[model samples]
Target: MTSNTAMIPSFTPSMNPSTKGTDHGVEDGVTGEKLLFFNYHEYSVKNYRLIGENTEDFHEQALIITHFPNFHVPRDSNTFEGTRIVRISRYFKGVGVFVPQFSPYLPGTEPAAIFGDDDTNAKFIVQGEYMGQFFGTSSYSPLSEYLTEKEFREIVEEINVQLRDAYNSWSLINLLLFVLDLLSFWIMSDLIHSLSKRKLDALFNFIDTRNKSLEKRGIKIISPRDSGFLSVCIVSTVKT
Candidate 1:
């Protein structure tokens, strides 16, 4: 977090044959706001809104989690209460797809990190300090709740395993296509409904990760009076 943040997370092309320095996760002594990069393009959304037009209530109910302050996105217009979408805390270990719940949705061996001393239901990110914020929370991001290091690790482990399997299986690609396809063929039908809660969640999580990684390089210095101004950036996407 220096005055020039970009200079720190640089990918060197010269003098790299033997020299070394800290990686992108840490800050050199520059001075930017304590950054929690959210590259909206590298990650995908994993939640109910991906399916179709979410109910208006769903918009109000969804939550987003981040490692830093002032970073978030709104839900798509068609989601239900149980839907989820979120980013991982930088402190999370195991950086892959995962599901914390122990059920049919659960998988085994993903990327995860353990943070803090307590062992409550917390998840750690490999990138930043631990703060158990999660998406779709009513009382703020999920990380605000004090998750013990153990509980957080367990949740991250669960998510990483799932993400790893999905990547190995190329399921993230398939699932995105599936969502787009399902949304397309049946989308025009007013009766279209969500395929499964698990599927939706996976999509949200995927998109969020993409956001953090790919979009981190760019930040808009918005006018304070209208912090909500809209700007557009072109991006490629899965074919319909």
Candidate 2:
């Protein structure tokens, strides 16, 4: 669905250093260099009322589409090289087709003019000019050259379904792991308690046998307070 309204892209002179009047190889009217520019288009999408609810959904969908078979691996990890399909899926997601009420416009247009800076305008203008050149001006649509709106929607929905399935699978795995961890902890605690009890029982048995032997020899060990005396008597008896 091509719009009848022609999008006239414009870029600031600062964006194109060639447009600046040079004085002895140095650009004239040059100010301090800007490292980063605020992107109005990104801000608009992030704060859009219609897309707010689906923003997280779209991000999850993008994640699944980009990393389909490799969900187990972290995205920042260098192990997985992006394939052609992955790159295509990422591009499709970035196109904002699934984002509700998203209207793609060339630079210096309504949203861009309202929210974008020089850098944002320059960026979009370059992209639009390139696309216009690649695809003929008469048949250029902002959506896609190959896929229709319906086809694109179908693909997005299919990817979303896959994403949901993956989330469910991961949730189940996490639950199983948690249960296993609890079970293991319980078993270890029980084993340690059992071992401690056995050792304590053996120590008490040894003390009882010693007490009985002392009693048979007319040396009656009465209370825990007499442990020092018992030690002395035992040492004396051992020496004898």
Candidate 3:
């Protein structure tokens, strides 16, 4: 059997009209309403341990059994679309064994029956109803007992601070990379435009020199738009 306890409080406020000739709720010659506030109430829960009888007669060389909840691994399109079920079991030889009493039993004898111990002595199982369907275990070594509320809060605050600092650093790095990408694009575009314009200017200069040589030999070339056909006319030179 397992039990869970949680405490929460609700706040409610009521307003009342102010009395005449009382300056307690008066502002700018107008009487303001008074509020009745109720404070929050707190409660605590007592912790208890369960002790049960051991009915199974097992040998002394039996391994200690610990049961954890079933877990599910999410599958994606890369793998499978369904969830995968998994269960885990941990075996301990000497450590994590809870012996209720010290008994001088033989190696083949049942420790639970010989020492009259309960089921808690040889097994540790967490109920799935209380701790959800999937629960994983983590170790905070050197600390045996559960942490206090203040200690847990402090650890959470420290983790949040570290995460914020990391986010800011990543933001700065992304900003720098974005700026460098823009600068590279602009420089490449300007270089290509300059090279294209230089080649265009060189081609125009060659065409202009050829036109001048033809004119010196008394040949006048007319454009297709002016002569209706691309044609060259021989000009008569009047030499005085």
Error of 2 at 64 (Å): 28
Q: Write the per-residue lDDT of candidate 1 for residues 1-240, one digit (tens) a residue.
A: 343211223333121111122233433455432232222211111232412343222232222222233333333422212222223322221232232221111111111111222224233212111123222211122333333345435544444455344444345655665667676785523343333434446644654564455344332221211222121111211111
After superposition, which runs of candidate 1 have C-alpha atoms over 4 Å from their true positions? 1-67, 73-145, 170-240
> Candidate 1 or 2, higher TM-score?
1
Query: For model 3, how does the per-residue alpha-carbon lDDT over 171-205 read when each residue is reduced to its tens digit?
Result: 66545644665889856544343332343344335
Candidate 2 lDDT by residue in tens digits, 119-155: 2223211111120121111111222322344543454
lDDT for model 3 comes to 0.23
**Candidate 3 ranges beyond 4 A from true positions:** 1-9, 12-144, 168-174, 181-240
**Whole-model Cα lDDT per candidate?**
0.29, 0.26, 0.23
Using all chains and alpha carbons, the TM-scores for the candidates as numbered come to: 0.22, 0.21, 0.20
Q: Residue 159 in candidate 1 has what lDDT?
A: 44
Candidate 3: minimum summed lDDT over ten consecutive residues — where?
1-10
Query: What is the lDDT ranking, best to worst?
Result: 1, 2, 3
